[model samples]
Target: MTPADCPEKPVVDLRSDTLTRPSAGMRKAMAGAEVGDDVYGEDPTVKRLETVAAEMLGKPCALFLPTGTMANLVAFLAQTRPGDSIILSESAHPIHYENANLSMVAGLLPCVIHDALGKFTADQVEQRIVREDDPHLSWTTLVSVENTTNRGGGACWELHEMESIAALCRRHGMRLHCDGARIFNACAVTNIEARYYAKCCDTLCFCLSKGLGAPAGSLLAGDPETMHKALRFRKMLGGGMRQSGILAAAGLYALEHHLGDLAEDHRRARRFRQALEAEGFEFCLPSPTNILYIRVENSLRAVKTLKRRGVLTLAHGQDQIRAVFHRDIDDKAMEDAIECFKQALALPR
Candidate 1:
């Protein structure tokens, strides 16, 4: 007995930008969706969505997954065996947010490097790969990169730099995996097609529920062999859902309409940054994508103040906060949030 994936759809939830409910057309499509049990690979709608994603990403195959974390874990499990090592930035979602699921599922070890700007060059990646002569070390078998790196304030990787890193990985007999959860935002901000970004990685996962405004789902794309492996791993993780077309419908709707809206999100983020600066709040770095990090004195108090004012954001640490702009957070919310910041700063220091 499986409960329908979209039992209830939210309309506007900007807390994480993943709360966006399906659009009206998406709901209608989901209600009348063509579905089958996905465990047997017989779900026509799921197959169609997978095919569409694969073709869009220039990959031979793709897997529809229940969540971005599962998509990333499945790819890692397929790429690395126990005791194999992989290099990734310290800010990678897999390292900080996935609760060590990488080690749990793939038996993979992490070699972390700091990437303050969210873009790691070829030299940085090559430096992390252990040399063949180093017998005392674990073999570095994979290089993982995150686009619009969450901790880097949604920064994007340049295409040329990524190509260079991919070539470096190939020379070392290492595969490259991209955790591109907000890749559509990257694509929208950079004005680049998604396939061009896919060219630099052996496998990649992108979320439909994030900036794309889908209710639930992410996609992992790769060559045929890897994708087949991922499909099997997906089921092993108990992610096989019946009638998943309800979720797939929203993904399709997002791909069609919401991709362009990410630029608007970026615009609003820039506006918010300007307002924050006007109130004497400085940024640690430039706001590139829809995510911006604010350098503040009392992070927790600021969060509480914003929450009280009907605004929501995350407190990263004692000195910094993260404010994410999404399609649902319009200009008015941005202004209200800025006022909240100013009011919070005026509190007893």
Candidate 2:
């Protein structure tokens, strides 16, 4: 069942960061946004948002799309042709959540990297490259890495590890695309600029709706040629929109104001995990940011019981319940959530 299946309406929804609503300031920005047709490249607010995103991410250009999933798919479509193989971690969002768009729509063969951590080393990627011109094998044309990997308990990639993978992709003459939906969270934790990571890859994308607290939108940044190709693919994929500056304005406001607050989200998540651990609760990994995966005997049962106690979460697997902290979960809510967890799990079975 979905998050909506909770028997009692949840007061503290920790299902995902995408649940964050726009603040009054962000809503004001969207309300007053100057708009024009974005498909014709005449939307002023969208242009400003793209320019800001490109400069911050150290890319030559950027494009705004409706969803993070489209931004990623456009990256793949722009870089590789049919029959090409792309390398990605087994725990990647595209592999699990994106409905096989990589294969069915991009017409690319995926070379899966079986890593439990949702990250792969440069050496592992180098070994997967198809170096031969044999007509039998699909040439490895692209490599993708996710920052603050979702399924791997929100583990952030080490800068050195990313650099090594980028170097390998450059040496192999392959395109490197970063599925950086939560890249800003990684930046907040590491105190590293987003541009540094962008420099190491051919293209990068970040979502406005996730931790950034925008209502909707994502941006993909790259050089002129790649972005031009991405623009075309975005249109082909029906991702083009008219008067999208309203949404773009919200994204711009998020980058300007909501970015710095990400640290607090991280702190709240760590605090939640720490309190739970003291109560004899188990976590799958150390949460460096806002995502936490709690290990339980039955994740589905835990989720249902937690919902009844005014807490909400997602079942990550049969034995893992996932909770994500965002702007909506304040100090009071966090305390209530902890109490709900202690009470739900301490129940007599």
Candidate achieving the largest lDDT: 2
- Candidate 2: pairs in clash: none
Which residue pairs clash within candidate 1?
A: none
Q: State the lDDT of candidate 2 residue by residue for 1-349, as single tens digits.
A: 5546765567799999999999999999999999999999999999999999999998999999999999999999999999999999999999999999999999999998987668999999988999689999999999999988988777788788999999899888999999999999999988889999899889999999998899899999999999999999999999999999999999999999999999989999988989988888888877788889988999889898998888989988799999999999998899999999988888333
The TM-score leader among the candidates is 2
Question: Model 1 off-target regions past 4 Å?
Answer: 1-14, 131-135, 346-349
Candidate 1 vs. true structure, TM-score: 0.93
How would you encode candidate 1's per-residue C-alpha lDDT over 187-305 as one tens digit per residue?
87787788998989999899998877788999999998988888889999988888898788778878887888899889888887887677677888775888888887788876656
lDDT of each: 0.82, 0.92
